[model samples]
Target: MFRAKNLWIIHLLGWVLFMSLPLTIVSREPDANFPMLVLKSGWFWSFFLVYAVLFYGNLLVLTPKLYLKQHYAAYAAVFVGLLILIYVSQPFEKLIFRKFRQEQGREARPEMPRGGFRNGPPPGLPPGEEPRPMPERGRAVDFVSLTLFIVAWAVAMAIRISREWRQSERRAILSEAEKAHAELSFFKAQINPHFLFNTLNNIYALAVSSSAHTAPSILKLSQMMRYITEEATEHYVPLEDELACLENYVELQKLRLNAKTKLDFNVQGQPDGVKIAPLILMTFVENAFKYGVSNHRESVIRIAVEVTGSHIQFFCQNRIIERREDVERTGVGILNTQKRLDLLYSGSYDLDIRNAEEVFTVNLKLSGR
Candidate 1:
């Protein structure tokens, strides 16, 4: 609304400046009569009305409906018609000015001498001499009118085209933002179900054996589920909250591991005031436990996270022991996490993964808020 009001103010100022030129010229005359020469003149009022219609009609109607629509032939036809109207109407100013001069001559004339020649040469003129007629200003007036008409037409087209271009650019930016939002939502939906499925299977194994750890595992699962359903729905969560959730998950996974499996988890630096994308770090740790643990052969899995100011660093490595088929399924979660990082952090994060023969490693760095 403010922008529209400003545009109207600009147009009003421009027309006022254009109308001032004639007033300035008339004021320079020796016996200038503002009311008789300008205010009462039919030509002055007609010029204002006609050009106003031309400028606004072209800007609000013709340019958008015809020129912008690629109807060049129809646009040209209408423009030529307006020019013809201007040409035909040019004679009005000349006729009005002539009538004013005749009235002035009658009012200023002195009483003629008795018996003197009527409508003849003046007293000082030589015999057989007639006065020369004043030079005509009709051509000059026509030229000025034509020039102003062209200027108004050009300015109207320029303004309309510029406005259209800006609106198009705004629409394009809005469309891109909406598409990115939808893609990020899809990735988060995939991560939630994948995490839940793996954790449930571990609890089922403990329940079959009637281990004492089974009851405690169920309590920890409830806490994790509460975090997922409530806090994880947000795009970003406090670093401390995410860390607590991760600790709960690690403890639950430990209940299913044998003494031969060695696992190390570590965190460095204070998490105060730091924020990170929800559930962004869980996929890598889950992959380590799924493929790196063994019941008979010795196995090791390591995970570490460090925070320094707004920067976060994560590293995870594990000895691969699962079958080839299981290792192939690991790509699903990792791929989805990578896409989420691109949409959320884009240039602010980096991730590297290596699947060697004996060990698989993941290193990720994030610039957080």
Candidate 2:
């Protein structure tokens, strides 16, 4: 967007260039007295003023109010009317020039010698021949005036159309950004409730069993909730903060695990200066716990995260002990996360999922800014 001051500066510079065009043409003439020509030629000054008015009128009013609004007949009528007005008014300059020439002739007559002929042939002319009358310059002047008028009209139209195109492009970009922001917020809202529902269920099981780990599980839930409400509300959070939240969630899930279930969680790398989209990795961990744990049979779930500078690699694998009845309903979290990834990471991240008969696996890679 151009600031008001800058826009005015552009307009001023454009008009300066427009006004200099006449000076440029005049400078090419032999023995041209530029200042005198400009001062004596009232028609040239009037021409400049008329075209200046026409340029602004077309730009500020005619184009926007008539041509752009599809008032084709009215715009054409107005254009023809202006042309007729110009043609009719131009002869007044000829009259003014003729009067000026007569006055100069009258002033010079008294200075001639008493016996000298007033209308004699020039010295270079043949003795019996008369000098040819100078050709009328009106046709050339009219041609130049018409050309200027057309140029003024074209320049106005071009500037207005170009500005309108730029503004339209900017508006489209802003609207798309706003829409993406709204979608990301909606997806985050859905994720929060879904995550809370599962965590509360885990805490409930511990409470009903009267297990000694119930208090610690509740404390972990409190910390995770605090992180969600505070740090996770932003589009991105520090990698260490997200890892701490995930660790709390994992510990809470461990309270319900029996000796028959074995889980391994590992993380390697310093997380300084690294950040990621919040809660993007939690859904995979939640799925591993939901269907991979068994009370009476051997079960194993593995989760690993490796961070190197601005790049992160995550892996999760689990044995599927319980089969899902409604595939669509069970895949909601995954779908939601995928949408967020598309919006946030776009082409900067990769995700792969494998669902085998006996095992489920997820591999994700992220490149952070």
Candidate 3:
């Protein structure tokens, strides 16, 4: 089916579109010398048809060797042969004209065979009756056509290779960028575990000191430390994993400040399959435990998460009950998280932080993968 379609289109569009200039001139020239007009047009058309057939085949046959194998001499030989055949057709033109006329009523216009025209001269020419000038010089026509073919072939090949090279370079650069981002995250992880280890050690000190609430604190620290070290070591974790880690950290803080600290953090959403950066939630949780939980005054921290479709919202609010005399600002957690969001989310996430009156709050909206 494809071959048949190609054949039909080539006859219609290819001949009519590309060869229209010459075909139109021959068909519609207004000069009226009936037999002479047919004679000249027939001879030239026959010669041109043969030249086109050979020239197209020459391109397919020679271009691969010239570019891929760099066979310069083979390219030259092909051009020489093509020039010879095209020039020689000028001499055959008169003969072809005579033969085509003889066959108009002698036989039906020869059925076109495969590649191109299929008719050749029949057997009725005696020994010594040929035209005087047998078309000696066709160098100008031959050179013009051959040079155009070479130029077009070279341009097409260069464009193809250059496009492929640019695509490969773009892919390599993107891969290197991704690797560097992963390494930076690893550096950040190192800092995270250091903080977790110190908190665990503090819990251990409380236990070995045999404080009255040591057992519950030890268990809380165990769960929180497991979550910090184990769950936050991935590119993306489930939303539930992050929430669980946050709750565990808050519980440990509650154990340490036994009945003096309160936390109100909750989540109600699709808890599985939604993906997020593993440690993004921890900075807010850590900040709440550090500065908001007061043992002797009114202190409360509230956190809520809502997820729908590919969007997620995390809201955190904590009272600045233990604000130091000279301290009037948020801490390193929010700053580092701001930088991380700039690096990882860019235009894809929104963050708001406010410290008004005695209350501090953070609201984050992020996209899930």
Instruction: State TM-scores per candidate.
Output: 0.80, 0.82, 0.55
Give the clashing residue pairs of candidate 3, or none.
none
User: What order do you get sorting by lDDT, best first?
Assistant: 1, 2, 3
Candidate 1, which segments miss by more than 4 Å at Cα? 1-5, 21-46, 90-118, 121-141, 326-329
Give me the runs in candidate 2 sitting further than 4 Å from their true place. 1-4, 27-33, 36-45, 91-141
RMSD of each: 5.0, 5.1, 11.5
Question: Residues 38-99, candidate 2, lDDT per residue (tens digit)?
Answer: 54666656656788799999999998889888899998898889877666665323433333
lDDT of 1 by residue, 114-144 (tens): 4555678677888876655444334545655
1-369: candidate 3 lDDT, tens digit per residue: 345347557435544443444334334435465435454655646655654565445445555547446787877786677566545544332334345446444343544443432343334645555423323443344343344344444544554455457778989999877975776475466448645765786677777888776777677667766766676666677777777767766666666664766778788788678888777877776676667877687787888889887689998888887567323233544666677677667799999989899888989999986
Residue 256 miss distance in model 3 (angstroms): 2.4
lDDT to native, each model: 0.82, 0.81, 0.63
